[model samples]
Target: MLYRKKRYRINDYVFIGDNCHIGNNAFISSSVKIWNNKRIENNDKITQCNL
Candidate 1:
């Protein structure tokens, strides 16, 4: 059996690419541009992306 992961959108301007892992109860601020395969653990606040 293939393993399918669950996905979710942060907000209107925030973009979460494929394979992005956002832990439970994670807090992401506005305008955060997270690239592909990024893992954000719980209680994390993302405001911007350097890449």
Candidate 2:
């Protein structure tokens, strides 16, 4: 449970570069944006996720 990177609302001029890891109850919103550097592991276990 660790996420900071400026609240991750990067878009309109995206830029993400580093050893990133995004997982554990994941739901990246606001049009979804990604620039560089990648690592996303979401252990799915949802019965109802409507958003």
Predicted candidate 2 versus true structure: per-residue lDDT over 1-51, tens digit per residue? 996543222223333346656666544543444435665447432222121
How high a TM-score does candidate 1 get?
0.66
| lDDT tens per residue, model 1, 1-51 | 997554433666677788988976666766777788889987666767532
lDDT (C-alpha) at residue 35 in model 2: 39
Off by over 4 Å in 2: 1-20, 38-51
lDDT of each: 0.69, 0.42
Cα error, residue 1 of model 2, in Å, equals 23
**The candidate that achieves the highest TM-score relative to the unseen native structure:** 1
Give the TM-scores of the predictions, in the order they appear: 0.66, 0.26
Each prediction's total of clashing residue pairs, residues at least 3 apart in sequence or on different chains, is: 0, 0
Q: Which ten contiguous residues of candidate 1 have the minimum total lDDT? A: 4-13
